[model samples]
Structures are given as structure tokens and as C-alpha cells.
Target: MISLHWLILSPLIIGTTAKLMPIKAAKKIMVLFQTALLAAVTMIFVEVRQNGPLLENIGSWPDTIGITLRADLLATAMVFLSCFLFLAMVIFVHNKNYADHLFFFLFLGLESLIIGIFLSNDVFNIFVLIEAATLIITILIMYKQASVSVYDGMMYFLINVVAMSFFLMGLGMLYKKIGVLDFYALEAALSQVNNPASLILPYAFMITAISLKAALMPLFSWLPKAHGTPSAPSVVSAILSGLYVKTGIYVFLRLQTTFAPLIDTSELFVILGFITAVVGFMLALAQTDIKLLLAYSTVSQIGVIMIGISLNNPAAYWGGLYHLMNHAIFKSTLFLTAGMIISEYKTRKISEIHGVYSHMPAVGVATILSILGIIGAPLFNGSISKFLIATGASGSWIESGLILINLGTIIVFMKYGQLLFGHSDKKEAANSDILEKAVVLTLSMLCFLGGIFGSDLIAILFNISLTINPLSYGEKMLLFVGSILLGLLIYRSLFKKRNPLAFIRSFELGFNEICLSITLFFAFMVVYLKITL
Candidate 1:
């Protein structure tokens, strides 16, 4: 008999087999399987809500011997969010034709790895799951068969697989020392030791490896390439950016909590988070391609989430998790809108794709709402979480720094909004597929309504009633207005004359490679300097 835990792998197994069938059948089968997966996720989420954490040991083996599959509040929340997006993507793709069946294989493989990442108890298993995800997602990016996507996918695969190898090695060392592969066991072992060398080296290795996979700054060069170039389904990109990236951070969070004694101070993570937040926005501000801009924005927002997690306070943790969900919905919807616009207008360049509103009102309105949500505008889902993040960082320099990041976010969105509204000479669009429109509109509505009731949702999810009232509403509204004003000023002063395409042309190939190499060199040098000095 199949257990409830194995339900998570149902779509993966079915989709993988279906991909071997005829292309037409493969897509239909995959869609059905995805719906089933969604149902499974919903049931599991209901279970988690009613009963704290749900656990099942595969094969009915003892806890120490068999693999344990556990769904905690965070894990269930991520799964629920990811599965929701995946179903939306399935609907969006119903009308879009693909030549081959390999896409379903890649999708299923990623889904399996996602579930595995959240369910597995062993540290080594997590590494394996991540490696599987990396390999499969790379294939998905290359499924486009375009030279750009293929080359970018290869680079992303190489980088992430290498990072996972490092993670595995670190886990091996920890297992060797502790005689167990369990996170709880290894953490307990680390706490009993006093040697900084033994603890810090492994801890640093684990965090660094996971951070690279999460596309946190300095190691995030591959993100814009892969995400921007792939014929990424909005649902796929949503989960990849939303839930998969968070898996790395989840590991780091677990390590921080369980192995706090062995971990380095939060100082390093906080500093890196700050760097990631600032640098990502700066780079994002310099992009002309809509997808690439959103990709960089994702990198920047993940940085903000990291900073919140690094604070190690309950407020920060809750805020980080909240923002993670908010970002998944809004950014994915934004990307979906971008895809729809590109499909209709036959261009990825934001400058070339003007007057979209003239032909694609639903997509345009959805895009605008998604942008508003992400910008943390008043009554949007994003504002609530952003406020929490800022509130958590209050009275610290981090707060001030986050203010700058928020301002940058607003500035970028302001530019995006201008692009949405500017230079209209009515041009007819090629395809206005009803299914695609429906999916996009659904996601966009979620972004709007999610913000309107963010507080009630938070209470339901975390079992804590946050003190939110009219006063809090007014305060957040002021922050939003201030950000908008600053963004307008920045755009008027700095971006008024520059040709954005020129910047993109310069960075196409060499910039990312150089940045990645330099970061790897610096990581090595940090070690060398530590030894020599």
C-alpha cells in the first residue's frame, strides 16, 4: 500500500512516465498529474494546520533506520504556495505548444526534488535532492533549444552541481565526526565541542554552498541568464524562484537553529545579505529586458529575505517567510505577464514592447497590479511583509540600509510602470489565448487580494494575532508614498538619458563570467588570508 507521504512523489512518477509517451498525450497527462499533486498538497496543508507537524517514515522502518518525511509549518506553507503556482502554469501552458515531451520530464523531476527537499530528514539526502533539482532545472532551461538558454543552463548546472558537491563533502565530514547523517544528531554533536576550527569550517562550507544555490549575491550570476533565457512557464519560474531558492535558505535556517553553537555569528550572513540586497537592485536598475530585470529583482528580494532570517528574531523569521510567499506570487505573476506580453508583441526588450496596454488590457492590468504588490504599495500583500522586515530591523543600521533597498525597489518598479504606460500607438497583438489570460488574471487577483487581507492570513498561518490597526496602516502608507517619491526622483535624475539596452549589450557574456570567477577567487582568498594573517 502506498502511504500518504508518497503522494508527494505521485506526479513525478506519473509525469516522468507520461513524458515517454506521445507529446500530445504527455502534456495532457502531466496536467492531470499536476492537479493531483495540488490536491495532495492541499490535503497535507490541511493536515499540518490541524495537527502541528506531520511525519511518516518511509517503508514503515524505525526512525533511526528509515528515512523520515516530515512536514512542518514552513514546509507545508512553501509546498502549498508552489503547488498553487504549478497548477496555474499548467493552465497557462495548455494553449502554448511545445515540440517535445522532455519539458514534462524536467517539470516532474523538479517537482519531485522540491518535495524531497522539504520532506527528507537526512542532511545528505537534502544535498542529493538539491543536486537532482539543479540537474533537472538546467535541463528545463535548455529545453528551449535556443543557444542562449542552453549555454546559460550549462553554466548554471555546472555552478550549482559544484556547490552541491561541496555541500555533500561538508555533510560527509560532519557525518564522520558525529556518526550520524541526521541534522538533529549532528547539531547535538557540534554543540558538545568547543573547537572553533572544527565547527566554523564545516558550518561556513554548508552555508556558503546553500547560499550559492539560493542565488544570493556574489554567487547569483547564473540566475539572470537561466531565468531570463528559458521559455520558462510562469508556474515553473514561480516555484523555482519562490520555493526552490528558499530551500537553500531553509537548510541554513535549520543549521542556525540546530547547530547554533557550531555556527559562526550572524554577522557574516547579515553582511552578505546587505551586499546582496544593494548590489542586486543596482544591477537590476541597469537592465532593459523585462525578464532579466525581474530576475535581478528576485536576487535582490532574496537578499532582503536573507537579512530577515539572519536577524534570528521571531519577527524577522515570520516576516522573511511572509515575504518569500509574497514574492513568489507577485514576481511569478509579473513574469507571467512579461511572457504574455512578449508572446503577443514578439519581443523581450521593454523598449520594443510599448503600447502593450492598447492590445492586452487584462495582461497590462495584471502586470500593473503585480508591480504594485511587489513595490510594497499600500494595502498590497507585499507592504505588510516589507513593513515587518523593516520593523524587525528598526533601531539598527540595517534598517537604514533596508530603506535604501526599498527605495531602489520602488525606483525599478517606477521605471517598469512607465514602460507599461508610455508611448502608445495602438498595435495589434498576435495571440490572445483565453486560457493564458485566465491564468494570468487569476494570479494577479491573488496578488491584490492577498495584500488586502495579509494580516488575517498571517494569523491563520502562524497561529499568532499580530497587533495591526489603522495606525499601522497609516505608517505603512507613508513608507509607500515616501518610496514612490524617492523612486521618481531617482529615475528622473539618473535614468532619464541613459539607453538601457547599451548596458545589457555590454554585460551579455563577459560580465557574469567575470563576476562569478572573481567571487570564487575571493572565497578562496578569504580562506588563504585567514590562514596567513
Candidate 2:
């Protein structure tokens, strides 16, 4: 029987082998390995489904002493997503002059690390995998030479290293407190620990570290720079923005559930999410650079995911997970397509690239559909998940916040759509690459069909009978149309400036510095008030 560790090791072995082979041969071998790795992941998924989560005990050690490899539903879903994006990226960049050997090795190594991070049940193991993933991302960012690449890679490296430091510190604290580095052991210790305040220092540090890497607000200063700086191949852009960031949310979900009692901080997540959603859109509205705009949108969309997690309801959990998957699909497709646009036009300014449709009709159509999907247009993949999120917030104060963010999403995408339709009558040379067309169309089709059949697909995964009743449908459609109209009005009336918005952008750059300074002061005052009362 092939153990789950095999999934993590396959890519490492291939990458090491590539170091010893000719570049051409290495590329071929790595590609073959990725295909086989994908098959192995799928088989693990099947095993998990037929049995329960398949977990591997390392080195014949007792279950209590050994690191365990796990393949739960969430991990399997991420693996599947990684495979899809990997294959798409391979095709998308086939003609580009990458260090074929280096590119495939790094790409496969990154995929393997990603799966390892998702599948590891041991806390120490998670730390190791995270470090490996971070290193790969750094290399990926700096692989090609450009000033922006250097700048972004430096920022990413600094922030993540600091984040990892905090993560390690937290792990050490937990291990000291519990005498074990497993999730189960930590949970047991947490239940016995008095004074939740003792855990806050570590929690705050760990969460902040992950937040910086994940590009959560007020720690999102490095995001637009990092994601925008890499002259990303389309597929790389997709995976970075769509899939990589979600790993933080995954950690948030796992740890928050395990340490629920110690966390008297659910409301903090809601408030932070509100700030992120608003700040992200405001920043997005201010950007003329199309890729930067998408980067800001990533910040906003992640806020929606955080909101669902904070809601603390099963429906919210399901909705958040569903939206996470859907976001990965459509957002990645959009970014990949956007990459193709940049390659063809040699510009990142949306305003300057008028009439792309005249030459690349497939790209134009894909862009339109993807924009619609992100905006939660009816029957698109995004709508159902968006609706579920709102419904999950129904009859609560947060419902209003959800509506506000929904409107924000619409407006940002409306602005994006205008970019797509700009100069529809202008003509360009008819020189379109087949690979570009294939990737754009494939993603667009998924966006369209995913929305239409999302409920059915989600049902199958959960193994439950999901009914699409009129009440649910009507409620969703109403919110959808209302949000769209509201977004359009906001875009036309308030955000029509040619100059980009620098209001919140200014905050992100310096906000974290101020936040760190004042957090202790605030904590002191709160404690002071409690004592006096």
C-alpha cells in the first residue's frame, strides 16, 4: 500500500532527479511525475471517501509518537485544486522560455509542500511543511529578474520569516505547555489550562504571522506588491492568488475549532473581516493597474471567507468552504486570462488596453464571464456560495455587513467589466496563441458550468440530498440583483476618478507598525478597566 507520505516525497525525488538530468529530459520527467502524483492524490481521495480520512503513521512508530499523514475532505479538495491548476499552468507556459528543469522542479516541489501542509496532523510537521512552502514561494517570486520581482520577493521573505518566527514561538509555547506537538494533545492541554489570557500571547503572535503571509488586512501591505511584482505565468498567478492564500484560512479554521474555549475572540475576527472587506475594495477602486486591482480584490474576497468562519454555524462552514473552492476556480481563471492579456499587450494598465476583444475574442469572452462570476451574477458559480453566506448571516447584525461587502464586490467587478468593454470597436492585429485561447476558454467554461451545477456538485461531495427550493432561490436572486444595482450606482457616482484611491492604501503601509505599538497599550487599558470595576 502506498502511504500518504509518498505524495509528499514523489515531487522531492523528481526535483532532485531533475538536478542530475539534462534540462529537456528533466522537464519531461517532472511533467510525467506530476501526472502520476495527481493520480495518487485522487486515489487517496477515493480511499478517504470509502473509508474515513486515511492517516499514515511514520516509521512504524506508535500513533502517539509518530507524525501522521492525513487526507480529509478538505485536504483532498485542495489537492484536486492544485492538480487542476498545475496542469493548466503546464499548458499555459509551454512556449515560454523558463528554465524548464528548474521551473518544473520548483512547481512540483511547491505542489508537494502544499499538499503536505494540508495533510499533516502533527503541529511540528505543519511547521516544517509551512517553512518549505514559504521557501518555494520565495524562489518562485524571485526566479525571473525584474526590479519589482526583487522588491516583492524581499517584502514577502521578510514578512513570512517574521510570521514563521511567531509560528515557531507559538508551537514551542504549546509544546511546553502540553509536552506534545500534536493537535489532539494541544487540545487536551488547552482544555485543562486556566486563564485564557495565557494563551492569547501565543495566539496573537501565530495569527498575526499567518495573517501577514495570507495577506489579511491590516497586514496586507506586501500583497499587491508581491502578487503584482512577479511577471507571473498565467497559471502561477492563479495558484498564488487563488489557492496559496487559502492555506491561512485553513489554519485559522483548524486552530480556532481546536482551541475554541481559549478564543474569546470570535467577534474580533468579524470586526477584522469587516475592515478587510472595506479596505480591500477601497484600495482596489484606487488602482489603475489591472493586476494590482485583482490583488486588492483578493484581500476583499478573503474577508468574505473569514466572515463565514467567524459565523460559527455549520451552514457558514459549508458556505465558506464552498466559496473558497469557487473563488479558487474563477479567480485563478481570471488571473491566468489576465496574464495572457499582459503577455499580448505588454501593459498592465486596464485603461490602456482597449479593444482586446477585437483580436482575442476568446479572451474577451472569458474575461466577461469571469467578471460576471466574481460579481455573483445569477447562475454563475459564485452566486450560490455568496447566497449561502448571506443566508448564514441572516437575522444577525453581521447580515448588514455581508450586504455591504456584497455590494463592494459588485462595484469592483463592475469597474473591471468596464475595462473589458472599453474600446470594443477598436481593432488589433489578429495574432492570438492557441495555448492562450485554450486556457482562457477552459477556465471560463468552468466558471459558467460550476455556477449552474454548484449545488449538485456540493451535495455529492457531502453525500447528502440537497434541495433547491423556491425560497432559497428567490432570496438569493433578490440579494444578487440588489447588490449589483447598488454596486453600479456606487461605481458611477462615487468612484469614477481617473486617479487611483490612496486612502486605505496609505493605511496598510504604516498601519501594522502603529498597530503593534498600540496593541499592548490597549490590552493594558482593558485589563485596567476590568480591575477597577
* TM-score of every candidate relative to the true structure: 0.92, 0.91
Give per-residue lDDT, candidate 1, residue 323.
86
lDDT of 2 by residue, 1-533 (tens): 56778877777787878888877676666567767777877787777767777777888787648887777877777777777777667666666677577777788788888878888888778778888887788778877867778767776776667667877887788677668766666777788887776666566656666666566666777777667764755566678888888888887777786678566556667777778888888788777778888989999988888887787766666777788888887888788778777777778877777676656788889888888787778888877777777777889977888778878878887777665655643455645668767877898888888778877877755544445566887877887788777777777877766444645445545335634633443354246334432
- What stretches of model 1 exceed 4 Å from their correct place? 1-4, 19-29, 230-236, 423-426, 499-533
Every model's Cα RMSD, please?
A: 3.0, 3.1
lDDT values of the candidates?
Answer: 0.74, 0.74
Q: Model 1: how far is 470 from its true place, Å? A: 3.1
Off by over 4 Å in 2: 19-28, 424-430, 464-466, 497-533
Candidate 1: how large is its RMSD?
A: 3.0
Model 2 worst lDDT run, 10 consecutive residues: 517-526
